[model samples]
Target: MKLAMKYIILYVNDFDKTMNFYKEILGLPVKMQHDTYVEFDTGATTLSINTRESIKEIIGLEMPASSVASQTFELGFVVEDVVATIEMLRGLDVPIYKEPVTKPWGQTVAYVTDPDGHYIEICSAME
Candidate 1:
């Protein structure tokens, strides 16, 4: 038997907006995209955005109602300039869940939620 993990897919209501949020605002590279899907190369993992209805159809399950916990996954990405990145994202109208703070892990980090409500943490290792 073979067990391996693949990509994480986020069911977004608006695919384009979500894609733009990740690509333009978050600066993740878009590896592939179509009318219904967008895939990003997130270093160690691939992240995807697809329509909610399409995702439900694929999984043969009904979509859940939006809630504080519905979109609970926290996607972390390495960043060089935490403060500057937070400011740039703020300028683009992205919600800042938390501002940059030094963590015990020796990283300066900040948090933001995507259009679909998934938390994204940006961090830089302390020198």
Candidate 2:
């Protein structure tokens, strides 16, 4: 059997801010929207955001209040120019987690923190 990615859901504190970030800031089209959930069109997979309170109610399990350790995963997005993207995001007051750097593999990559504390990787597409 093969697994296919359907959605990457983020449980966030400010649902509205995250929704608008992916919509207007990142330029992702909205596929669907609900009271506490919003899904964005991100090529093959869907990027979804939901309020932490809603997730707790749906799962009926105790969730961690916040993460105090290092980040485990990053939401990566390939763009035309890494420097341009970083500069634009910086103008909008987005937190830059890492400055643009060229990897030995010949790709440029940078990291920015999302509204909900998730790292968003802005990078050059593989050649």
Candidate 3:
């Protein structure tokens, strides 16, 4: 059997804020959208955002609270300049989880959390 992942859906409390972070801040074009749901054009795998309340009501899910301190999952994005990207987000009043640090493998990486506390890694392309 074979399987392929198509979307990474983030169930969020503040749908508008999370939507704006990915759309206005990260600059991901919206692939589709509704009052409670949105999908971004993120390469082959779509980045989706939906309201937590909606999902819970629909699927009867009891999702745990969002957390940045506790380990969970991370979303990665490659940018041209890690430092510049971090600075840009910082200027917009986005909370900076970690400053940019060049890895021993030659890739510069940094971390930040979204409105729902999902960790995102901003990095330079692997060299």
Candidate 4:
């Protein structure tokens, strides 16, 4: 099947805080928004945030507990300068999971946790 669009929908407990993190902090442009949902334009894919209450209404089930330690996936972004990005995020008081460090594979990377405790990685472009 040919996929035309892609999106990662994160069910968050605090919708406004999560939305502001991606919009104001990360500088992602808003593609769509509502009282319960928001979609940000992230290059080829969209990063969407939906309230957990809305998800419960749609699916008729409660969402499971969310924790950064329990998350098995991360949202990754390729930046021109990992060090500068991490510093800027730090200045804004964003939680830094890992300081910028060069990996054995030659990529510089750092980790940050979003408002909802989702792991986000900033890294240099892969060679």
Among the numbered candidates, top TM-score falls to 2
lDDT of each: 0.82, 0.87, 0.88, 0.89
Output the worst ten-in-a-row residue range by lDDT, candidate 3.
Answer: 63-72
Model 2 root-mean-square deviation: 1.5
RMSD per prediction, one decimal? 2.3, 1.5, 1.6, 1.8
Candidate 1 displacement at residue 66 in angstroms? 2.1
Q: Evaluate candidate 1 by giving its C-alpha RMSD to the native, one decimal.
A: 2.3
lDDT of candidate 3? 0.88
Worst 10 residues of 2 by lDDT: 61-70
Regions more than 4 Å wrong, model 2: 67-70
Q: Where is model 4 poorest over a 10-residue stretch in terms of lDDT?
A: 63-72
Instruction: Please say which candidate is ahead in TM-score: 2 or 3.
Output: 2
Best by lDDT: 4
Ranking by lDDT: 4, 3, 2, 1
State candidate 2's TM-score. 0.92
Per residue, candidate 2 scores C-alpha lDDT tens digits across 1-127 of 9999899988887777887788888889999988888889999999999887888898876556664313778899999999999999999888899999999999999999888779889999987
lDDT string, candidate 1, 1-127, tens digits: 9966679888777767887888887778989887677888887679988887886777777766463436446888888899998998899899999999998877899999988778888889657
For all candidates, the clash counts are 0, 0, 0, 0
